[model samples]
Target chain A: MTPLLDIAELAKRFEVGNKRLLYAVDEVTFAIGRGETVGLVGESGCGKSTLVRLINRLLDPTSGSIRLAGTELADMRARAFAGNANRARIQMVFQDAGDSLNPRYTAADAIADPIRRLKKMSGASLKSRVEALADMTGLPRELLSRFPHQLSGGQKARVGIARAIAVEPELLILDEPTAALDVSVQVVILKLLQQLKRELGMSYLFVSHDLNVVRLLCDRVLVMYLGKIVESGPAAELFADPRHPYTRALISAIPQADPDKRVGRLRLSGEPRSPIDPDPTVCRFYGRCPRGEPRCSAEMPVLRTVASARQAACHFA
Target chain B: MTAVPALAVEDLSVEFRTRSGTVKVLDHVGFSVDKGETVALVGESGSGKSVTAFAVMGILDPAGRVTSGRALFGGADLLALSEHDLAEQRGRELSMIFQNPRTALNPIRKVGQQIADVLVRHGGATRPDAPRAAVEMLKRVRIPDPERRVEAYPFELSGGMCQRIMIAIALACRPALLIADEPTTGLDVTTQAVIMDLIGELAHESGMATIFITHDLALAAEYCDRIVVMHAGHIVEAAPARELFAHPRHPYSAKLLAATPGETVSLAELASIPGGLPDLRRPDLPACRYSDRCERRLDDCARPLPHRVIGERHTVSCWNPL
Candidate 1:
């Protein structure tokens, strides 16, 4: 079966001064199966956001193909993509629900805006649909009339999720949806997302820095570093036995709630190498890798299959 | 255990006046940090974690006023101290690392100069020799190529780098007590580990008392020796880190732990604590702030909460506990 979303050789570059090129998203490739929740994990400046923007068509990619359900989307200009019929098929729930929502817009209005724009429904139908969406997302009906500021963090998050799914998008892109919320609220939101995916049969591209959350929610995981995907595999297998050094560092860095579970951590020493005009021949994790050797700096390792349904970009995996 | 604590806060009550009304931010809060010990003030936002830290630092907003309490540090009352005395003790004997390092740092000043300013002001270093000491501090924080990076501005560095610079400034004077408020909230997990390791090592070496305020219980469990769980301006539970995780006596603490994602728990098993924090400004608030959302609440919850001693070092303020 064809995947819900297939991305190949996706790259986005920014032109810094002095004829320098910042490779924000460099030759990334991944796919999401229908109803599958794929997690994208990486640190800051790892091009995770840039890759999300490219797939969402909010920003034009420098090169590569983004095929949604076998339909080419990269060829369409980002500006024109807004009016395209496929616009409603892909939706994004932003990181900060409070900031993403318009302050003046009431919760009801926020959820209705997307449905009205995309579905072209109005009057009683739109009102009932908004109410239904609220009910589906477990948002209290009375709170729908309240503005963003009047609602709590978890309420605002519910509104954001309701708005994104109002159009019944085939794929939902969640960019750190629970980063700003408390753990108690985060669990509710994560459960809601999972339920929504099951009910609607929608695919999810869950991008988050919280490895614990990713491990719980994602079916497959992609570990990106400095714009390149260093590892990709089944979530359980990858986290249990990460092949790439970067993935290993990220997993071990997660602070375990159980103090007894604490072990000696694998610390990444130096900062990430400069992204601007980086040498293509050198590995991105070379300087910071705990197991770095001369072979790592001399040759860039291409991501290759190492085990059953596991891939790692390293000289020795 | 008998030695005078590095910092002892007794019944610290703070109130903030807002357009709505007077908000009781901290209600008779009390905790103690021993010398060379780390205690985490763990809670969700608006749980008075930062407010407690701000009150101790004497940097509470002008609108906020300390209604009652005594913060004893080295046999001196920090609350009763004058502004001048507080200022003198702030950078010299007490220091804080703010949440956002980019804003905490001087934007226009070079990173090295900022570190130097702290050293010269509190470390008694001459202006001419302060720069050299600042570079050494940067190197100690593990900033590679400290000589070149010292001249760089805050904006020129990454979030982690700026945070290291902030740590350098905070530890330059080797203050007896340090308050780090969500120092690694926005940082990556890898950077968070490194930064936390750096702070832990430095504090261990200096025998400094650390008050770490963060909402992440997991992080608190990993780094802190004790965990103080706060809710609606009240400390519901305080216990040793392992004991708190292994057996949370308070309902709120148990709920919080259940909510936190872990290696073994699946998404379906994670139980979110229902309801939001009660409004602090309400005049008819319940004696137990968590009673409204608590499943084990009883009629007795309407009365004053009792501080139940479970273990030698564990305490819970609750009418009905787990």
Candidate 2:
């Protein structure tokens, strides 16, 4: 069976001053299987947001193909793609629920706007559909008349989820949906996402900096650094024994809640190299890598099979 | 254990006179940090962790007043100090690292000048020599090429770099106590680990008492010597870091631990705490604020809460503990 989304050699570049091009996403290739949850983990400036925008058709990619269910989405201009039929097939739940929501729009109006625009429902049907969505997302119906300011953080998050799923998309892109919420509320929101996926039969591309949450929810995980994917594998195996040095450092940096489980961290030294006009021949993890070698600067390592279904972009892996 | 604590806050109660009503932000809240010890105040938003720190730092908004409290530090009652006296003691004996470094930092000034300004005012540095001291401070925080980066503005630096500058400014005078309120909230995990390690190392070397306020239970467990769990306006539990995680007596602490996602826990196994924080402005707030949401509440919980000494250093305020 064909995957829900297949991205091949997708790249986006912005021209900084002095004609220097900042390669935001560099030759990234990945796929999301049907009903699969794929997590994208990376530090800031690692191009995760750019990749999300490219796939969601908010930003046009400079190169490569984004095929959704065998339909090419990269060819259409982002402005024209708004009116395309595939727009409804892919939806995104933004990071901050409160900031993403317009304060003037009530929860009901926020949910109904998407449905009325995409599904083209009217008056009574729109109200009922909004009510059904509120019910589905476990948002209180009575609170739908209230504005974003009147709602709690969790309630705002529920409305955000409700709005994203109003048109019944096939693939949901959640960009740090729980980052702004409390831990208790985050658990509920995550579980709701899981249940909604199971019921709706949709694929999820979970983007977050929280590795623990990513490991809990994702089947496969991608670790990106400095505009390139350094590793990709099953979440459990990758986290347990990460192949890439960058991945290992990232996994070790997470502060475990259990004091007994605290281990000496693998610290990354120095800042990330400049993204503007980066050396195409050298590996991205060269200078800060704990096990840096001369060969790392001499050549770049492409993703290759390290295990049965695991891939790592390292010469030593 | 009999030695005077670096900072001791006793019976701290604060209220904010807002347009709606007077909101009790902190009710008889008290905690202390020993010399060279790191104590974390952990809680969700509106849990009064930051407010407690602000009360101790004398940085609360004008409308917010401390009704009753005695913050004893360095043979002085900080709460009763005059404004001029408190200002003198602020950066020299007490320092704070605010949550957002980007906003806390002066956008128009060079990062080096900001650090220099703190040193000149609090560290007794001369105006001419302050820049050199500022560069040394930057190097101490492990910022690469401090000489060149000193002239860069906050906007020119990344989030992690800006945080390092904030740390440099906070520790310039080597204050006796440091109140870091969610210092790593917006930073990446790797950056957070680095920043935390830096703070821990510096505190250990200088024997500076630290009150680290954060909502991340795991981070508190990893870095702090003791953990104080707060809910609404009260400190529900206080214990050694490892002891609290292993044997949490308070229902709120247990629920918060169970709610946090960990390496081994699955999504289905995670428990979400029911109900939100109670309205602080309510006139008839219960003596035990968590009793309404707690599953182990008893008739005794309606009365004044008891701070019980359950173990060596563990204190819980619940009437009925797990």
Interface RMSD of each: 1.0, 1.0
Alpha-carbon error at A148 in model 2, in Å?
Answer: 0.7
Off by over 4 Å in 2: B1-3
lDDT of 1 by residue, A187-298 (tens): 9999999999999999999999999999999999999999999999999999888899899899989998665666755889988999999998899998889888998888
Q: Assess the local accuracy of residue B298 in candidate 2 as a C-alpha lDDT between 0 and 100.
A: 92
Tell me the lDDT of candidate 2.
Answer: 0.94
The lDDT values for all models are 0.94, 0.94
lDDT of 2 by residue, A1-317 (tens): 88999999999999898999999999899999999999999999999999999999999999999999999999999999888889999999999999999999999999998788888899998999999999999998999999999999999999999999998999999999999999999999999999999999999999999999999999999999988999999999999899999998999889976655566558999999889998988999989998889999999999999999999999999
lDDT, candidate 2, B228-288, per-residue tens: 9999999999999999988999999999999998879899999999988999999999999
Among incorrect, acceptable, medium and high, the docking class of model 2 is: high
Candidate 1 error regions (>4 Å): B1-3
In terms of TM-score, how similar is model 2 to the real structure? 0.99
Q: What is the TM-score of chain A alone in each candidate?
A: 0.98, 0.98
